[model samples]
Target: MTSLPPQEFTSVARAEAPLDENRGFACHVLIIGGGASGTLMALHLLNASPDMRVTVIEKSALLGCGIAYSTTDPGHLLNTRVHNMSAYPDRPEHFRDWLRQSGMAPGATDESFVGRQIYGRYLNDLIARERDLPEVSRLRCVKDECLRLEETPKAVIAHLGDGTCIRGDRAILATGHAVPVQSHAVLTSGWDFTPPADPGQPVVIIGTGLSMIDHLITLLRNGHRGTITCVSRRGLLPQVHTETKPLAISRGHVPLGAPVSAILHWMRGLAADAERQGGTWRDAVDGIRAHVSAIWRAWPEAERRRFLRHAASFWEVHRHRVPPDSARWLQEARDRGQLRILRGRFEEATMGEDGLIAVRIRTSGGERVLPAGRAVDCRGIRRDPAKDSAPVIQDLLARGQSRLDPLKLGIDTNEWAQVLLADGRPSRRLFAIGPCARGAAWEITAIPDIRVQCAELARHLHAIEAQDPVGVSRG
Candidate 1:
């Protein structure tokens, strides 16, 4: 587990070896995005094949944090319990063990929710440890944004922002999510925040989901005693998690051919029956989660769209539950009259004089005008790859090398996550994981689910690499 010589960690331009010819380069895999998915993928691949070469290109200088875990605000806490936050399923206590070994409290078993920055540090430390592995000597990480990707006869060429290109036999797009979108008027008017404004001034948050919660925490931590308003169509906050009993429902018991509405009706009835038998609905939901993927697969595209349009928000709020502490804090904030949650549609927004923004919101009661000192858009990432602004994704789309999913969930792919082309054919050497594969597999975002996918994908990549013995040079 010795460190590679400093020279070997130099920039791509100054590396000892020159870029391979357009003919092709022999490498195990080239992974894009050094966030959780990409880093874990690299670790899995390296662990499977010590002789294989793996390179991770990260847009941000920091690796492993990605968008969800990158916040520095102490108030931005993880919503899940520490015990269940392990990056690997097989290692159920991995995160808890790491916490203890790092000199934190021992035998801490409460559903404790810690700061997001602390979680980021844990992820970074894990990556550092993995990099020290003897097998990881074959792993190379590049700190550059990928601008374009082209699949050649022999290899895939990844063009970086710095105008340099690298080729690999296989490529993986773990690009993760994009930044939240802001209103066009806000951008054009150059309405940016200068903190420490009057505490009583009003502020509007664009989305009432988890991101909005983060903004609320930030505003409070900044000592802003202002009236904070979070507006969304459904005006739903994340559901709070609670201890529950287990159920006897198995995957085979759930009918697959029924319409989604019918399924929901059946599920509701089952939950009611469970409640009559002295069990909570939480038990039923947990039972359904065990076979959610199967249910999702059984649904037709129309049914899926119906669910998205009618029930996605409700599902999200329940599926992504909040930790008890954060839930209490939010409740307290509301009870104190400092925070307001409005359910409505965004009508329009205008800039006013003296650092003020007027937002017109439309609710069932009618239009209401609210003045805000500052506005923050926290709607979360755009999931449609066709509308994505990332250069690498755009390049692939232009060349017909990759196609967007029918539902625009992200890129099109098979169950194995092999990226499909315009002609609806899966590429042998190009695979995708994480949020990018949502179209192919609905439930792939959570760490536990993603780790399993990475493990399985790693096995596939390793089998392929074994057949082709590509020798990677070590420093």
Candidate 2:
């Protein structure tokens, strides 16, 4: 068997094939988001079934550039390498191959860390090519927002903001990472960066994670000479992506359903052992990425909460890493006394009599007030999705159609990506994938996990339709 890149798959290689659409329901799938998740779902559905139609409605103009990949910065390289960033799980080298064929990165290799903007272009081109294909005629890309969704006995109707209602056999919630709006920090948009009126004035950023790094890079690129202060609870920065030797971790090696404490001990021991073998702790961290979801699901609610409270931050810093160049630049900024990280949590911000902004932080010493000319909330992905989810998600929750996860990470869903209702019934009509299903699978937020989830859910829907045609709207 051919060896897959580190982030592509788990222990063993398995074969996948499209189901016989001749025996399946020739239905339509309405996806609310047209980012990577939605595009991947549509592709898989079209490939797996012959007659199924997929209409992808994205509020943004682009098809596959979600909040994460929409950035146009050349300096912002993908955290993961080319080999692991493919939109297809089975086609491990698809992205690498695309890079070479498209001349986007003619010399790109499996280890090449290409610019995110180029990757965004790659996704856009990928979907664009698919849509133009006669075989993929079932794929429809709509530029609109689904404001409300209504499920009928025979169909699902999506009401768009433009006064257009789309009726399909089934609806999917692929709306990725919705950051709850209102930022008292005054700088809400991470991707859209406007040069500060006074570049020399001190700037305060709210989080010390990847988002923070993104803003920092933008600031430096734009020649901002001001001192930057990044605030977070522990002020932990993400590690940098590095070359990793394969670590063969068997499925049985993971302590499934065990206490979070035991899991933590195992990870520490694993990292220690890897270091002893001349490999970095990163080997141990990357080794467990595929199994985190299973371990997350196996834990009791109490144990899950305990992990979140105690070890989640450390895990995240090691797990979700930055590009090597970004890490090096960050180090240089720190060395020059231009960037400093504050160990505290952002509480409030207020406008002073002067034009400056006073940002308040709750620290161990006491409540400290930091005055700055500008402030931004780089709080990263773990935002309050319950309050600021998509318009359709909010409507669903208000109408008791769907419920939030116990931890409020995102909407609650079952293992098969079926949306769980308030009454705890699985929603055969509505399904969620990608970040929205983070509560169900913690790793689904990344491309590797998301591609697999999309593939599985597409197969699952086809299989279900084969048994019972008419699919979700049969009610």
Q: For model 1, how does the per-residue alpha-carbon lDDT over 1-475 read when each residue is reduced to its tens digit?
A: 1212223222322132344432232354789888878877877777666555777888776778787766656667777778767777677787887777764435545456666666666667666666555542566667789988877767787898889988887889998875433544652111123343677788888778887777776677678888888889889999877886657787778988678788889788878977998987777776676666677778889988888888778778877777776777778889999899999887777888867888888999999887887777666667446665467777788889888887888888877778888899787678889887777777777776688889888877666564654321110
Per-candidate TM equals 0.88, 0.92
Candidate 2 local Cα displacement, residue 293, angstroms: 0.4
Q: How far is each candidate from the true structure, as Cα RMSD in Å?
A: 5.6, 6.9
User: Which lDDT tens digits does candidate 2 get at residues 102-177?
Assistant: 7778899999888877776677777777677754356667777899988876778889898878877788899988
Residue 445 of model 2 has an lDDT of: 82
User: For model 1, what is the C-alpha lDDT against the true structure?
Assistant: 0.72
Give the range where candidate 2 is weakest over 10 consecutive residues by summed lDDT: 8-17
**Candidate 1 wrongly placed segments (more than 4 Å):** 1-27, 104-107, 134-136, 187-196, 245-248, 273-279, 464-475
The segments of candidate 2 whose C-alpha lies over 4 angstroms from its true place after superposition are 1-25, 134-136, 183-187, 472-475
